[model samples]
Target: MKEDTPPPSSPPPLPVFKMPRVHKQEYWSFVRLVAPSTEMPPGQTAWKTTDAELAYCLKCKTTFKYRSGSSASIRKHMNHEHPHELGSVGREAAVKRMKNALASKRKSSAVIFSPTKRTKKINPAEEEMATRALIEWIAKCLRPLSIVEDEELRFFITLVQTMHGIYELPSRRTITERMQAHAQQLRSLLKEKNAEEVDFYSLTTDMWTSRTTDSYIALTIHFMTDFFELRSYTLEVASFCGKHTEVRIRRKLRDLMYTWG
Candidate 1:
């Protein structure tokens, strides 16, 4: 048998959603006033009225605006809320005064003058004369000590000549041998004169790295009398080590000191 079924009720009408309208008074109260435009560019779907206006604040100095039936409403609003912020001249004068005060303060604290003296120009002739005098003085001082002789000067001149492509200087090995012999001669002289026994000799020690990759420690002892005089001596060199320690360094120095004796 066929059964009668009630027709299905239509689904409840889909709910319609609507955005609430923003009042002109409320919008203008928060935003600064700008010129009214009849034709707003596309994508500007928020502001509907074209005749909206704004107002500017003089203190905290911000601008505010609102929409009203007449300009009386805007004037009344400004008078009620910000009566003291009416004049633009007072604000401009205050800004100018502040700027001038800052400028004056900076000028007072600035360093306008330098304290250091300027360097004077050097005269080439004077410089040359001084250098010549110094060389002559050095030569004269060494002549009495027998260190500066014609032969030694000629040897140095020849070395300079070699640099000028004239003659070759002595080889490194020859130079080393000559230095050793000179050192031995000086040591013997000190021994003969009993100068090494003097306790007030000045000593200078220096360490340098050679082109041959060897590290050398050179010690020079200058024996002088009570009278002001300089005695040149050969410098002794030795190898240095890490594990040798400070005691070993002192021992090496002692050995060097004993050599003079």
Candidate 2:
């Protein structure tokens, strides 16, 4: 019989490399919403961020945590936990902003503000500013591009504008249209650069499941500059039906490459 050997010694502990700490002020993206200078839903004290992505809510009364990815969740928590904070004016402001947003649209590139019965004086400048801010906010964090039809969210933004003096937001249709145009513009620019600057390219593909248990695959392209700097960008993602078998993956890959190639 073979003698039992002693277990291998444990690997040395990982070096205690201290990561540089991020100050709250360094998170300028959240400055507009969480900073004391901007709007804060009543009953909530100034918010603080540790990782620049997750925020600690003082209004929560305890060490309440929420992601800065969606201001909607933060508002939902406030509405449920502190309903009294969102007063009458806040609600009315929301309704007014929604109404103003739903007013007829024009062919101009800028967001139009329509004056209604309740609020006779509509400031187009403010409306444009608010629209730009809202769209930019949604785009920056990769939030759902379909935030236009989110009425409850529109109301929250309206209430925020009450203190921040931002104008009423645009309608969902407008938001969608503007985002599409902006995306197209960016795509055109990127395609031009890739065709001009890059000589050769490589591709990477990933198959994964979403929260809803949907299977999908994303394709990313990689290239290098004359200086040997690497660059990568996701070209597109599509649903990969059936099992993630190699055959199925190969078929999908063929389809995408044939189309793009």
lDDT tens digits, residues 1-261, model 1?
Answer: 897542323211221111134233322232233434545558775443333554433233343444544445445655566543332323445556655665564464364544453323359999899768867887887645344466657555434533436665689999999999867765565565544345576788876666876766778768766566667565577786544467877878888777756
lDDT of 2 by residue, 33-81 (tens): 2232344457865444422332333343222233544455445555665
Quote model 1's TM-score: 0.31
lDDT at position 136, candidate 2: 93
Clashing pairs in 1: 28-65, 33-54, 54-65, 55-64, 55-65, 57-62
TM-score of each predicted structure versus truth: 0.31, 0.35
Clashes of each: 6, 0
Best candidate according to lDDT: 2
lDDT (C-alpha, whole model) for all candidates: 0.53, 0.58
